[model samples]
Target chain A: MDKPIRVLVAKPGLDGHDRGAKVIARAFRDAGMEVIYTGLRQTPEQIVETAIQEDVEVVAMSILSGAHNHLFPIVVNMLRERGADDVLVVGGGVIPDDDIPVLKEAGVAEIFTPGTPTTKAIEFIKQNVKRK
Target chain B: MNLQERLAAGDVRALARLLTYAENDYPEAEEVIKNLYGRTGRAYVIGITGPPGAGKSTLTDKLAKALRARDNTVGIIAVDPTSPFTGGAILGDRIRMQELFTDPGVFIRSMGTRGHLGGLSKATQAAVRLMDIFGKDYIFIETVGVGQSEVDIVKTADSVVMVMVPGLGDDIQAIKAGIMEIGDIFAINKADLDGADRTKIEIEMMLDLNENKAWRPPVCKVVAVENSGMDILLGHIQEHRTFLSESGELVKRRARNIRNELMDLVRDRVMEFITRETGKKLTVDDLVQRIVAKDMDIYSAAQYIMEAINK
Candidate 1:
């Protein structure tokens, strides 16, 4: 049997609201994937270390602190440094349209803004994970 | 491949990847688990739970550091809350334990409840198993300090620690009923506060009422911010581990945990299968219309759906 996709959902910086993160975690569980939430106020290094330690195929971060410009790139670079370049870097939470391309360029797989459905995120993961 | 071999070889990357696969309930995760299951039972599982502001994160950091000082490798699993809309976690535990991130002897992973109703995420057990396989002497599981669900999740630990603070008014009473029974060690953090003594007494009162025949859970006071009383807390943890081994309940408790995990996984899988099979043929609107028209009773309708799937 194939393994379910393992995702590390992280909140970076100091945004304390987690209602959306909790909802998405439930959605992924229902979708039959294993989801690990790294609680709030994480640094980029910690997020990458967690992804490496957990062997997560995807590292999805939720940042409402508007610090995505700094945090996302650092996380992407750290994953690369750890030779986890294959691990997908994705994020959500109040990212403006102008910054989406920059985030993608920085190696984030995709950026999810508000109103994105849980099913959409799950589907994106299912489609993109590098199958072992 | 054997888990011990994988771990002894220092394949931290592989160890983590395997844990992730296992936690997700992937079909392949089962084989990985079967291959590595016996390699587990060596690591001590400690569950840290309490109210939100009790500084559970800070205590976890101190404990990890203390355990490392004793020349033991540590694996920390911090369970955070998940975002509902995006299915992501607000991974906050790293803030308190950032110092340990660079330490070779320490590996920290923060996890979210991910909308699991029972307080902890389903992946937590698998993560613990992975940490065990990775050869950590201690694996610490910390939950967001809610109530019943947190207690339910921590029950899987080999030893459970309940953390409390002096200033979270009425929270002591609020946490009394469900958490009081499962705690192997009670920590009243922020002992520098005015009511620290009162909080300690309250915990003692609760502990006295629910004395265990096998082991007596101790109440210790600490100021987590200052790293006070950590040594005593570690001592109590070691004592509890000794109690488990000596009482012959270690294996029994582990077996029971395994049994519960298997049942939970089976239940989850069965529900998924039913949902997928039925979901294709029936919509919520369809059921509502049927009930509205009095064509079928709700229970019978459910039975009909189940029978269809079975057939």
Candidate 2:
């Protein structure tokens, strides 16, 4: 059987607003990707552990809190240190435009801001996921 | 090191990678499982199944924690439905069990039932074996929110804990026959709700009509989110485990399950082989398309399939 692209959509840091994450999870499912959604308030360690255990090719986190610059890169680095560098780590939700380049330099494959269509994220994952 | 050595040395990444390959039916995973098959059968498998919104995942999280507090290594496989049209799924069972994410003693995997392949239960059984080989003391297989007739978990777990909640479809769901009989233990989660006792009595009445009375399935009230009644639920599950052990039914039951799973595995493989084309030959799918177009009959298609495989 052909394997579907597996993605882990999580809400990291203290922000509990997960409307964006849930929307992406649903969109991923509709796009024929198996998404493992770990609900709100996850730490970076918890996110990376789940991504590893699930063997997900993509880790897409949505954080509304102002800690994306701090927490998102930590998750990316942890995945790399854990030998999970193959995973495509992406971040979304309330972040300034200037920090996007910094996040990209920190090994985040892409950053989807609020107005970015879910299809763009889906397309990015399709083009970037290592498993495919 | 090889896969077996890595697994033996407690490599989580290797285990996770093997599980992916196993689910996709890769030959490397088959070789590893063949080598480590003897390491299985030591872990106790518990199946948590119920309708959607029954709190099975929450109950599962609490149960694993309870077992972990007693220093037992736990493995959990939480199953969710795959989309029939899109072949995708949202395996969000971990949303409730996220607290166990970092616990080295617990391994939780979320699975989607891609029935287009029809090998879901087979892969699930293999996953259980792999987890057992990984040295878990208790393995919990939580089924997708099931209706009647999705009882494949019976072929995987030694004990099936059927979860129930109050006010779901009223008394109709309680009286449903097929899934109701498979519960070795009945848990009325969200028991703090209004109709809990009524649901309990409904289960008792139905269980009294069970054909095999060797063991009486206990109906326990539980509020999983608050963690109340968990101890009693744990005690009852333990007691049921001991009963199976004492009466020697555990061995007999496992053997029966293995036999059934082996039969399913053969069917899965044969179906896989038949659907794909052999060189330039017409496969079963093409034959079916012909039958649909009235260019070929069903009997001739069947004969062609038989003859092609015989070659």
Candidate 3:
């Protein structure tokens, strides 16, 4: 049987504003995926460690704190250092279009900005989740 | 390297991969575990259980920290409920456990019940055993918020800590059946809340009526999020462990748990046998149709199945 995609919904910045993260977590659950919501104030190291420990196929993070330029790449790089680069890393929450290219350049699979529908994120995960 | 080799060499990724295989029940998992079964039985499993909105996760996190401070490795399997309609789950138990996320001594995994009825997933047994083989000094299996009759934690845990909060109920709620009887330690979490003393007293009253006095269950008041009273709670856990060993109850309990596990496996194997191809013309599908159409009673179907097996 095919496994449901396991996504780690985490907020990897200092921001405690997890409304967006919670919303996406709920959306992933409704779409028949297992979501491990790691709650707020998670650092990049914590996020990467969690991604490995949970063995998640996708790490969907939300950062409204504008620190994405620094933190997002750190998580992607850490996952690579841990040889878990196959995990589909994605991000959302207040990232500007200018930073999208930068984060994508750092190996983030995709970046969803505000106003992007939850269905889009769900579809993106379904299509890109790495299955070994 | 093969999974067993890497696992023996202390590979966390291999351990995590095997856990996934175990959770999914792939055939590969059985092969690995069958070979690694002999190395298990060293880890002490403690079960943390309570109703929803209780601080079970918080309690688990604090307890893991305490154990780590004592220089022990801890593996935590935290269970949450799956959505019955969508067949999905939001496993948010580890949200309370992020403090221990980067700690190498602690490994935390969250599980969804996955339509399993007893507040634990069917894969929980395998997860526990895998953690045992991974050389953890202690294992904590925190169940999904449980009500009466969801007591599968007993099958996996050497000691059970039933976390309770103030104002969950009055007299009738305090002494309810099924769950109230299983605790080796009754921890009144959220002890800063009102009526904490009353809740503690209520559980003590309930314990007084129990017939088993070999080890009287202790009632401890704790504020889990504050890290308050955990030393004493851990002391009680260690006390119970010593008591079990000194009293020879550990052997008997482990023996009984093995019995329950054997029965569970047998039931699954039998059901699989009955449902799969029988090499005969008659099938369970036909038997089910007949029963649903009222042409045959369920007892007749069972008899027919038994007879077919005999033939």
Candidate 4:
């Protein structure tokens, strides 16, 4: 049997709202990916830790709290520092268009803002995950 | 580092990959398990199983929290059913376990029954071994405990806790399902409900009918959602663990489990070999056709395939 794509759907940084995270998690599961969801109010450290422990190919983070500017890069850099550079980091949920470049430069693979179809993120993961 | 070295050094990534390989039946799974087999036997595996909607997951969360409170590192595996059409699964057991998400002392993984593969219990065993090799003190395997087909938990868990709610009105159903014999401890969750005392008494009455029993299964009342009475349940689990160790039942049971594991592995390998050989050549189908045409018997055809494989 082939190993299925594993993704971690995490909500980081005091985001009490998890509706978006839950939706993405269901979408990922329906896309045939194994999704381990670390529920609300997770720190960047917790997200990265879970991503590594779950052996996820992608970390799809949903943060509506506007802390993406501070937390996203920390997760990307921590993944890099821990020799987990292959773990692709993606962000969504209320991220502004202007911060896209900075988040991309910080090593986030892609950012899906509002109205982005779940398939777009699913396709991105299928296309970009570093296959072994 | 190689996979085993990385896993031994507490690399969660390595551990996760090893489990994936094992669950998917990749060739590396065998090599990795073989290399790390000696490092296992440390983690005490506690299985939490009950009918769906029986508060098994909530109880699992409370139990993990209690175990963590004792400074024990915990690894949890929640097994849910797989979707046949998409080969996917929605493992939402962690919904109520949000608190453990950030706890470094805990590691959680969800597995789909993957009905095609037909070995959710075996996959769970491999996951438990990985956590054990990673030095977790306790491992929890939670499965939707319904029907005899899925009772594989009895074979896998060191001490099984059969969680029950107050309103499940079938005392004889548990016996029919063979859950009564396998439960090392019974937990009446949702004890705040109307039938709390009645449920406890019912299970006790059923247990009283059990003969030739050395250690009686204790029925502990708990409201897992409220985190009430968890300490008492944990105390019972610890007591059972102690009894198993001091009475040498632990060694004996583990030895029996090892035998079962070895036999299952042998069967899996033999079946793998047969499938590989049969896939390359259409021998099995041809034999079946011959049998259908009344030219050969099924028994002889099976013997012929076995002989060909041996050669």
- Output the number of the DockQ-best candidate: 2
How do the candidates rank by TM-score, highest first?
A: 3, 2, 4, 1
- Tens digits of lDDT, candidate 4, B1-311: 89988889987778878877777776776687678788889999998988778898899999999988889999999887776666666676777787786787898887878763322545777888888998899999998545444567877889999888887776776556465567899999889999889889889988888885788999999999999999999999999999999999999989988788789878978877876786566567787899999999999988877876786
Interface DockQ of each model: 0.23, 0.89, 0.82, 0.50
Model 3 residue A11 distance off true place after TM-score fit, in angstroms: 0.5
Candidate 3 structure quality by residue, lDDT tens digits, B1-311: 99888887778888888888888878777787799999889999999998998999999999999999999999999999988888778999988998899999889888888888888998888888888888999999999999877889987799999999999888678677888888999899999999999998888988888898999999999999899999999999999999999999999999998899889989888777777644366689888888999999999989877776666
**Considering just chain B, what TM-score does every model have?**
0.89, 0.94, 0.97, 0.92
Q: In model 2, which regions exceed 4 Å deviation?
A: B116-121, B170-172, B276-280
Give the residue spans of candidate 4 off by over 4 A.
Answer: B116-121, B145-149, B283-304
CA lDDT, candidate 1, residue B264: 87
Residue-level lDDT for B213 in candidate 2: 86
lDDT of 1 by residue, A1-132 (tens): 234566777888898987787788667766755676656777787677777876778888888889999999999998998878999878999999999999999999898899998889988988888854
Which structure is stronger by lDDT: 1 or 2? 2
After TM-score superposition, the amount by which residue A75's alpha carbon in candidate 4 deviates from its true location, in angstroms, is 2.0
lDDT per residue, candidate 2, A77-127, as tens digits?
A: 999999999999999999999999999999998999999999999999999
lDDT at residue A54 of model 1 (Cα atoms): 62
- Which candidate would rank higher by lDDT, 2 or 3? 3
Whole-model lDDT per candidate = 0.78, 0.88, 0.89, 0.83
